[model samples]
Target: MPVLLLALIVFLSDQISKLLVRQWLQPNQSVPVLNNIFHLTYINNPGAAFGIFAYQTPLFIILTLAVIGIIIIAYKQFPIHNRLNLKLALALQLGGALGNLLDRIRFGYVVDFLDFRVWPVFNLADVAIVLGVGLIIWELWRKEEKGEAQ
Candidate 1:
């Protein structure tokens, strides 16, 4: 499947889940999806991951756009086979970034709903970013092992 299509799926799923959570729960309110393990908690993060840059919306917006631009450029430049994983990772990141960017643009904050006590409140976007980054790192590691580059 095309990376863009996968990204769209991720973005749609994330937004739908967020919308449903918002419709059903109030801010700071949570329902136990799994007792003590998971809860649907609502939060508006006016910042980056883990609430960083809590007051830097403009910067965040600019950064997100720059990232999108870079991804588009990379997609055009990179060879298909070598970049399959990279494109997939970028698509996941793009979907996630767009998801929260939509919230930030519309509501002046990113809506986060998934809550795990071991970790701070986060949403699907965060998951995408983390997983995308992890896969990217793994790819790099595998490349080094193969002496493909570096």
Candidate 2:
């Protein structure tokens, strides 16, 4: 129940932010929030990260679906005890995947707007996905270190 709630929050946030950006900015338009440091730059990404494999909508859709399925299966298989972080990570990944997948299905591309001027433009879903992966790695490393100490 908690996982579903968290995922729903992420999905809603991602979609709302994208919708706002779409309404406020035109494609390739950018509004700097910080001097040359950060901006809201709208972009329609038709491919994976960094816009690689552009126009490969079908492939990305399939891959996202596969990832969503794997996350669901993995989350269910995780033991109920002491697996809060793992479960949270999976929930985040699931939400982010669904958010982007919906965009891909609706428009042949995913909507991105947040820009740091150092990395490619991305959206809330991407942030959630990256944070989720980071949390998973941190949790696994902590467990490994604890095992070694014991």
Best by lDDT: 2
Per-residue lDDT tens digits for candidate 1, residues 22-99, read: 899898898888999998889878888789779798888888888878777867876646667788888899898888
Model 2 lDDT per residue over 1-150, tens place: 899999999999999999999999999999999969999999999988999999999999999999999898887775635678887898899889999999999999999998999999999999999989998999889989889432
TM-score to native of every candidate shown = 0.93, 0.96
lDDT of model 2 at position 144: 94
Please state the error at residue 145 of candidate 1 in Å: 0.2
Runs in model 2 deviating more than 4 A are 148-150
- Clash pairs of candidate 1? none
Q: Determine which window of 10 residues in candidate 2 has minimal summed lDDT.
A: 74-83
CA deviation > 4 Å runs, candidate 1: none
